[model samples]
Target: MSQDRDAGARLGDSSLLRKLNLAAALGAFLKAPSLTLRELRAVIGVSRPTAEDLLAELLTEGRVEETTPPRQPSSGRGAGRPARYFRFRAESGYVSGLDIGAHKTLAVVTDLRGNTLATSRRELDPELDAAGRLSAAVETARACWVEAQLAPSDITGVACGVTGTLRAAEGVHDVGHGPVGSGLAPYSLPGFTEVDVPGALSEGLGRPVAVANDVKLAALAEHWKGAAQNHRDIVYMFAGHRAGAGVLIDGQVHQGRHGAAGEIGALPMLGWEAAVERLHARGAELARSAGTAAGREGEMVITSAARQDPESLAVLIEFAEVLARGAAVLALAVDPEMVVLGGGMSRGGPILAEPFRRELAKFTLVPLEVVTSTMGADSVALGAARLALDTVFAELLAVPGS
Candidate 1:
């Protein structure tokens, strides 16, 4: 017995086991609501006593609370009382997600349970200086937090999605230097790529911010609550002001070595340049006619005109081919089961989907199911919130030591 005790201590501390078990139970409870002790133990693969002990730890921390167990409509007592259930105290913490795009900045605040408390959006001037745009993005975040009736300390963390590559260690998203093309390119949203995004947002919000590619974050939203729910392998295509894709393998975003795996749509030879030309021309026409902002671009004018204008519908069909070409390239490489069309352009619907399918069929051997994003443009912001929520909970309640 002494030898066994010595061996166990040598291997690891017994307290570590309890901490791990508690983390598992807390994670399971967060994912699923109102779990009875038996169900909780079974779900997390722990003994009933271990589950109860972990639950005691959670209750003592004010992280969980006993709740009424579910009952039938025509309820009758089986014994002295029904099984008790418990849930995480969702109000104990909050998180914010932010989407900083080429043309817009959006922020959403959510409780630990994934409920959206408040949200805000603002159009960004494409020609603004880097500092001004960064300021605007952080302001949008603060505004959303205030709208939610929360304070900076109340936010457990923040996650931001931006257009370019995110360098986590340096806390920035570096948009490419120089012009995207020679002159007058639609992709000419300058001063964004090299900004210290995480540093700026953190300074304003008073909490560290995690950064991810906007399209990748949109894909995360697709998997969590939108078109790609229940899917483990998916390609989420973002086709708004600029085009991008997010690849998910086994329910995780595959960001690639340089965080540039799904940038297929950026290839000039792959029809992205042509698609941008056509889409921007239409948007420019509408902007001139309406006397709106000169720099307006992306899905708004196209989708609006598509509703009634034959010319716009034709343009959309042609551009849908461009979209399909990009999807085909990604699908060929990864062979994803589903392709989710997210971003503002996803609203183009069957007019876009039908023709896109026709063109996409031209490239691949694998069968693919395509769906539009139900979350629309909000996906990125909401996805960022989800990321923040996960990190916050993991940091707050989960055990260390892997």
Candidate 2:
């Protein structure tokens, strides 16, 4: 027994055991309608006492529900007694998510199962500084919470999806059209750069908060409940005023070394100035094709030319081909199961999907499945909500049960 204890200690600490037990219990509960103590112990490979202790905590927390014992077979000879079972409650609480984009900010409130209860959206100008943008975003978030009629206390967390680089170590950078602190004047989020956007909003709303890049958030949302649900390795691109992508490995979002794995727009084209000019020239050409003459769309505009006018369809076709080049580069490196199209212009539906597929086929080592995001404008916000729920309720799912 002493040797066994020592070996167990060496193999895994109490904390590691608890996490493993939690994962086992949660997996069992999710896979089946109900589970028994004996079955949970067998699955977790933990001692009976440890399993019982974990289950007790879960039951006390109302995350799992106990049920009557199963019926035993008639005992003409000798029949074993039935065992009590447990399963997830699923309706315990909710989380909130928001996606703040260049043109629009959206919010969604969802249950633990990722079901949306209410949603709201507000238009925005990319020219607004980080502080100004946050103010508008925060207002939209508050309205969504109010419309849902949920108390601030009931919210476990709020997850936000913002465009630009998010350095967990250095914080979010390049939030709007200008410098982090200077550009946000109109909406008035003082010290936007210094404060953690998630933490600040969480404090204001009295809940925990999580944040991720907008494109990554959209990828996660689609990974969890949209077009990429069937795939483990995937790439999601949100092409607009700025183009970005989110890479997934085994269903997990990859942030890369700098938390900027998908900054596809920065890839060099003809070289620095020329490449920048080419990107803008496309935008200008799009505007002219749309009959705007001077060829200017709103601030940070990319789709205004592609989606709003038929004359610009040729330009969009070329743009889509360029997008395919980016996708091919990503695929050659990552080799994802599918590539999902998202963002405001993806609303173009199959028009964008087919062209992208054609362009992608021209290059790349492996054939790729390209599809449109099923979640639409709500993808990023919903993904944020999913991230929050995973953070909070995921713990409850671990408790073992009778």
Candidate 3:
């Protein structure tokens, strides 16, 4: 019996080692796109046989495919025939990210390597109930999936970014009202807090789903492919119809025990609410004067401010001051390497940068670099896709069959 138990332990250890080798090989392919057997063995630090075995398993699983290396010019000294290569099959499966907000729902579909393949957007009525909003998100995702010419089964994972904090309940994730109630007042969707965002989305999309706060996702997007990519610690601020923040410490999102880590705007004393109201009011005035729709108020204010309109620029400065104050609070706590501004208002980041930096300098012990998001409105959705890709990789590494 003891001998049998020892044998079982040995089997487990071998299995674990094989999985690790497989993961290392997959990671190498992901980074290099294609590699010969010799190069892969070098990258993964495995024996030639072990690397070949890993390739075989991955090939059978459709995660990798054999490829011919690019033809090379003949050398005087005959270099042996170019070695065969294996390529990571990024198209083997797909993942999706969704950004659901008060004004719009956006869906992005990406390959395993996080390349955007298709996208769909839908406008939403601020007053739409939670169910209606969820439905809209589902429809948008389906449309995106269709645009990508993919079937439901082609999706390996799904992630949705919503306006509120997300909490785990009984093994499932649920959306909750955090500090600022999704950051939009009077227009915030009703009953959003009561819905299981992940479960609902999973059911609708016919795949397992994950959920996170939209601002947090935006921060992830920035770190993954936008302004904060080179920075390990960052503070991402969402400035537009509402104000919210997302923090990254050591290159990972800092979600508090209840998943509400960077909700500094919830504090009434922080003046986020008041500042947003002032901006909106000014935007409304600008919109009226410009004969544009109310929804264009923020854009009007930003445009006028860009032109150095006295009133618009002053309002922008005041708004920047409030934003900087809240950012200062986060900076003091985490000492992030940079502060990134995202959301609709990020389009005006060039105008807001100096004022925000000036105010942030006044409030913080150290001067911090401030940058605007290059991802723009797509940041949240791309971040969501990142989340989904993470889930897929986790599953692939854990399950040998996968």
How high is the lDDT of residue 288 in model 1?
77
With a 3 Å backbone cut-off (N, CA, C), the pairs that clash in candidate 3 are none
lDDT of 1: 0.79
Residues 1-402, model 2: lDDT tens digits: 432244457765656556556666666666666789988777766677877887887788776789765666776644677577998766567788988776677899987666788999998765666666677778888888789888777677688987666777656665322344553221212345566787666666666667788888889999899988889999887755555678899999888887868665554561222322455566675566666743233221335444455534555556567777778888888989889988665776665667778989989887888888788778889889878877775655554431
What total of clashing residue pairs does each candidate reach? 2, 4, 0
lDDT of every predicted structure (CA atoms): 0.79, 0.71, 0.84
> TM-score of predicted model 3?
0.89
Candidate 1's C-alpha runs over 4 A off are: 1-12, 43-50, 73-75, 169-189, 295-311
- Prediction 2 global C-alpha lDDT: 0.71
**TM values, all candidates:** 0.88, 0.75, 0.89
| Cα lDDT tens digits for candidate 3, 301-385 | 8998989899889988888889989999999998989999888887886688788888899989877899999998889999999
Off by over 4 Å in 3: 1-17, 68-77, 170-188, 399-402
Q: Model 1 Cα displacement at 281 (Å)?
A: 1.8
Model 2 stretches with alpha carbons more than 4 Å out: 1-33, 46-53, 67-84, 175-196, 270-310, 393-402
When sorted by TM-score, best at the front, the candidate numbers are: 3, 1, 2
